[model samples]
Target chain A: MKKSIILFIALLGLASVAYANESQIWGEMRIQNILGYGQEESLKLGVLFTMLQSKYFAWVFLGVLLGVPLVFFLHYKIVGPKVFPHSHKKHYAFNLFHRTVHQIAAVSFLVLLPTGFIIVFGDFFGGGTLVRMAKNLHGLFTIPFAIVVIPMALMWLKEALFNLEDVKWFMILGGYLSKEKQIINATQFNAGQKMWYWVAILGGITMILSGAFMFFLDFKMEMLHNITGLSQIDLLRVAAILHNVMGFAVVALFITHVYMSMFAIKGAVYSIITGYVEEEEVKILHNAWYKKLKEKGKF
Target chain B: MSNEMSRMKFFCDDHRCIECFACSVACAEAHELPTGISRRKVITLFDGIEGKEVSTSIACMHCTDAPCEQVCPVDCFYIREDGIVLHDKEKCIGCGYCLYACPFGAPQFPRDGAFGAKGAMDKCTMCAGGPLETNSEKERHLYGQNRIAEGKVPMCAAVCSTNALLVGDAESVSTIYRKRVAGRGKGA
Candidate 1:
């Protein structure tokens, strides 16, 4: 009888702890552990949140915001653009559907980057209607990006995959390091483009999902606990960390992609809009793709 | 009057708190708060005792180094000389960063935008109002009454029957805490 009574009392003891008791001690209530700091995960998350709010994220962003543009400026000044004719025989590269999706994603990203930077360096603008508007637009623009992200991924997935030819492309920097146009062997998408494609699609999806957690604040912790064994606040910490880390990657790659299209290779930006690749430029820059077309007797 | 210049703070005496929603009700009524907003809440801290209950009132403790101020992207928060943390509603984009950083869960948001998007952040202003002109019509409209400007205690503390919710200078509050601890023949 004593053993059975002890067993029943032990179950009762376990029940109290399982009932979401804020205090870890069986009877003592700790004021410090109230609210968000109630669990060990909550405590660790608090520390992370503090580090995030401090100059840590800002200093890292400063490197990207200041450091990247300087490299681009140097590249522009020294190497010069690979100039190509705008009007030429259209070597059909992208279709109307592909062009439309690319344009929408590009425009959305164009808005997202600046606004997101504004949010990252928010203290500079000193909060008001402008930052608030930026915040709202950031969420609003996510819709278009989210809609096109999947299609964009599937369309470019096969071409964006890396192969041995890409190794050679990476070695010579895709023949973009010099002024003189050199014939380069690159597949439909070069090594640089393949890297960009993965970053934009995968990193963008992670950023979107993480941003959603912050946007919708009313989602219950219990539901999240059932899924991730974490409280809502802990999940939020993870989201914020993921979002910021992905933001860094997206920002870096987006800048590179923009530079490669608009400045590094002249008239390349127009191809996305016009849905045509310059045949002469493709022959020089995409030698492998040009060879494939020649073998097929298309050119 | 001189005490107003000291760093302002709140100390809820956990021992005496009765969980009577007086402070919360008084704050809501005094501020004419929106339906979903409450600046002060009494929460039960311990329920292990068979019949006795220990509870405490919680709100924005208005920390010396306020985390909300640190995390706000818009630089909306500004601490006064007396250490009461305040923010500009006009500048707040309602991004909810401050909400995440605040351990107390002090920042409150009214669902104003479409699909329940957060409006400007609202929290315990410590009866000091916001960045607008003191006690002006616009200030009152945006941030409720400015009791501090009128030389009065915050409404919640003023109405606290058990004196559990203490609000004053840090030194004064700590002195009282020390006295209460000594009176109980123990230390917190």
Candidate 2:
């Protein structure tokens, strides 16, 4: 009875949180007027209605706030060192590509995250000396950040493709959450990790595209004019929403990925940082690849 | 007050508009609007429709109840006592809600700011002063054609060669319209 009551209370709390982030009343009225009525009415109802639909940033924030601690607790308590102990075998060859990609991703994401946040919250927190400084920094760093993100996306392109093994790995929860060690013969990156990689790349591309369009509104791009069929003002409004959504999505993914790597899987952090792992841990986690590398005398 | 309201409205005669874009160019020139930003445009609907193609000069309606004023996040838009809806360029963040809400595609933005930054919105303000102090140079440069204060009609209405465009109070303008419709009756 107590457990059921606790669950009920938790559900209610979640329901309230969901309701709190609802779009405004006027936005609802506008949507109804648009979908049910004619274009004339919809145009009269105006762009404010569309702005309400672009509040994905709120969801991204909630996902991170809840997902981070939950992942950490699950990793430490439920699936700690008992499942996967620290490895010391130093399998450097297998991790070389992974390590390089991880570093680039980390750096690019670090820059993107803060710049994104500043852009969103600039209205409230703007005009301060510190915020002005941060804005300058954000503008400066975004150039290199954009440069690295493109290559990072291309590097992970092959692994993100959907394959039969990826499907099976997904069906079995990537054999990470489930205690079935036999199902662990998955591909280079597990299904869950691959999903994260794909989202990062796709979401990153959206941010870059929208951000670029917004930054160059002054240029006479006849193509853009024809495509949106909107005045320059409308284009900027659309860009703002896209940039905000992608920014939040990237932040949420980063938090979850970090928690899983650093605290969830024992010794997962060490491999990336040191480029080495114990022989026993490798044999347990990645036996097939480990044995092949060893036979080739590449490790 | 009726005379004041007369300066806030615009009308185009469908019969006289030749779809030549002369009025559109005149509006832009009157405002000194920057390149690629047009406060007024000619929308030619139904091209080659066997005498049914309609060309209308579109700009701000200066609506009795403007939606742009209601939806602006910064409260940048204001309706003058004469009912002309004008916005403060300095306060505008280039969000474009006004462009979306406007029924006539009156609001325009410069496309040359850093990062495609939307410059402040420019639109037909019924030839009235914006939120700036009355008759200020800043107001003249940003809004353009402040004919309301000069006791004259708007440039678009004045420059209309065929006298197709009219600007005045709702009742008087509608009366003129009814007279025109009545004059064309009985196939005479």
Candidate 3:
């Protein structure tokens, strides 16, 4: 952490010549005016938006959407699946409410990600009826995801918070780098899972907000003028930029979450599906939680 | 020959504009646009602020390097040889990326989406119709008028009370603007 802080400070001071080679102050200023911030301009944010939209967003999104799966394929080939023997003994992990919320979030994500990509690389499909259908489907799925996102955050907030043991879990990369059955320091949810929780819930909310702005073009940004200080047009620009940036993170993290849940640990999905975990699987993968349960005589 | 093959353009002189909405109204009436759609709009900045007030009419402008063409997901926008930027309404998904990209806010989406979001895009076609055969009934209904093919000036410029809006060959348009500025003693 000390080294990271020092490096961060060093990088900050390394270049005093702070100027955007990719100038887009006008766009950012417009956004500031719309969101009711009343600022002169968001120079850096505009530069970033201009750079992303003009050149990088397509390539970066393409890389993440396609590259992540290729990476999982290699990982699977090397480490193979960690299959724990099924014992009739089980522990209830998710209740009906939890399972229902998870399903809603999952199904919405499944629809949104593909349709979002189709909209991103819209011209690839020749900008016709097919892409339009994807655009519509993308908007429709936002409703379900929006409903469950807050609940998902509230339910998982405690487990998703970082603990000292999570640092150790990170060092070993959650024991997935090797094909060995290791008693990991993770509780029910590991550091990686915690990261996914924040990105999905929090990032999902921001996407909903920004998507709403773009979705309902007629929705007035006037009342928000004093608070956000952005013109309506510029606010839309910021929303579009933010939505794309969030897409990059969500796509990468969501793919990892899916792969870990379904493929990395065989039969791991049973917990989510039936709200029961195999006794042996819990004892090995989540020893910390397993020990607590055992102490309480729940095991 | 130059007017036919050269770049077409629009220039809205703010000093001459009266904020009467005549250009916008002429555009809609001539094209028989829907209740809310305005192909040309007059914006008054600092309205009623005495000397600070300034108004200008704006439309597609048909930019040579249009940003909407760049960000469009469906590649709907195309530039004609005469430099009129047009889009095929059939291919438009109404996703509104063009609305975000446009500096002028030219692209307008009807609230006709699958949800209450949007439908296919509607925007200034520079009086030039879409990919359909020029002046067809379907083209007229989907994209308004095909006045460019009819060998007439776009109605917005034609009916401008103050001649604040002008559209034609680039050279002619600039010459007119230069003349206006010189007469106003604002040009060197």
Candidate 4:
């Protein structure tokens, strides 16, 4: 913390020297008259400034700090410490291929998010060395991330689709904050899980597209300009904006998804790791899918 | 805003420019810039045309609210009192956000290390250099000439044989531009 303060002071001093060379009076008039701080310019500055200085994100963190506890207190008040009783019996929930795909996706997301943040918010992470390293690693991980996204989307597409049963699951809050055991007739995934899947799939696709547009196509900007009616500048601007928006959404979803899997749900993380769940646990949670398996003589 | 210093702007007279490339050469020579980086360039709108080709020496326009400054995630860029948008190379991540953000394609990058990775962004500082001390060796190495600090016109504008490139206060430059256009009776 002391080091950070010292670094901050040094950087500010350096900046002041750069700025002080010019007349103080001219700067103000130039901003008001020549620069014309238009709405687009204002938004760009606002977004980039927030990323650099973290002033806006400080408020976001404060909201998260206050909101998370409020949510926890509400959940505690409503649901208390209710845990389902289950016997020690195992049943197949995920196949080997599904587990493999999930593992790849999980690892990629974990690596990509932090690296991406470091590159985008380079000011907070220190000088060019760390930022360059983060940028390189972020580029490298994007390849695996892009490859995994396609397979993961295909692997979970059918299970993630919304159905009439999902409506009932939503009505009961997916049995999340209920003291009574509301029998949610969900298949392999509940409404909440399905939502997570879709967000990851769609958001991941957007990130891949925008990232690809930024990385490879930049060199061929002239060709792109001829092919597309829009100028290369406009395309790049749109890509940057899209990349930022999708990045924020994906990160938010990933945090909540990880928290729910590891802490909120019992045996959930275990099931993902082992590719199996207790038969009694499946009977209570995924009763619809369990009944189908039983009728098929597979359970 | 004040009598001491005025908001500066750069203008290139299209009619007077002859696509000589002298301004570009003068800028590179004066700055002693790296081989790959050209801060100023003579851009021809049409090539191999009889009396239809229009060319102008272009560089950073030193925009009032520069998009490069606005979009830089590391906040490396800063506009001076004279509206000369300068950037700190120390703070720059070389992510090319400025390149993408700039409408004029002003930002230049040099390949560094093995496999030609992008090192840092180099652009027309408008002869103002960077955040370093005025006319310092470090400033010269990173940001080229500091002629603006020394109260001299930019090398590109200075060496233009036809007096095409003009660099001064925006008000004075516009007044000159208006007279030149009115004399010709056609806007360039």
lDDT of 2 by residue, B37-142 (tens): 6666666666689778866676777888676675554457777766788887766656555554554445666644344445566778777868777778888887
Against the hidden reference, what TM-scores do the models get? Answer: 0.87, 0.63, 0.88, 0.79
Weakest 10 consecutive residues of candidate 1 chain A by summed lDDT: A21-30
Candidates 1 onward: DockQ, in order: 0.42, 0.08, 0.37, 0.18
What is the full ranking by lDDT, best candidate first?
A: 1, 3, 4, 2
Q: lDDT of model 3 at residue A249?
A: 97
Q: Tell me which of candidates 3 and 4 scores higher on DockQ.
A: 3
Give the poorly placed runs of model 1, Cα more than 4 Å off.
Answer: A1-43, A85-88, A221-223, B1-5, B45-53
RMSD after Cα superposition, model 2: 12.9
Give me the runs in candidate 4 sitting further than 4 Å from their true place.
A1-82, A85-87, A221-228, B1-5, B32-36, B46-52, B111-117
Query: Docking category for candidate 1?
Result: acceptable
Question: How far is A180's C-alpha from truth in model 3 (Å)?
Answer: 1.5
State in Å the error of residue A126, model 4: 4.5
- Note the Cα lDDT for every prediction shown: 0.80, 0.60, 0.78, 0.70
How high is the DockQ of candidate 3?
A: 0.37
What does the lDDT read for residue A299 in candidate 4? 51
Interface RMSD of each: 4.9, 8.7, 5.1, 8.1
Query: For residues A151-187, what per-residue lDDT tens digits would candidate 4 score against the true structure?
Result: 7877788889999999988887778776666666889
Best candidate, TM-score-wise?
A: 3
Per-residue CA lDDT of candidate 4, range B61-180, in tens?
A: 887867777667677888887778898887776776776555566777676622344667888988999999999999898888899888888899888999999999888888889999
Clashing pairs in 4: none
The candidate that wins on DockQ is 1
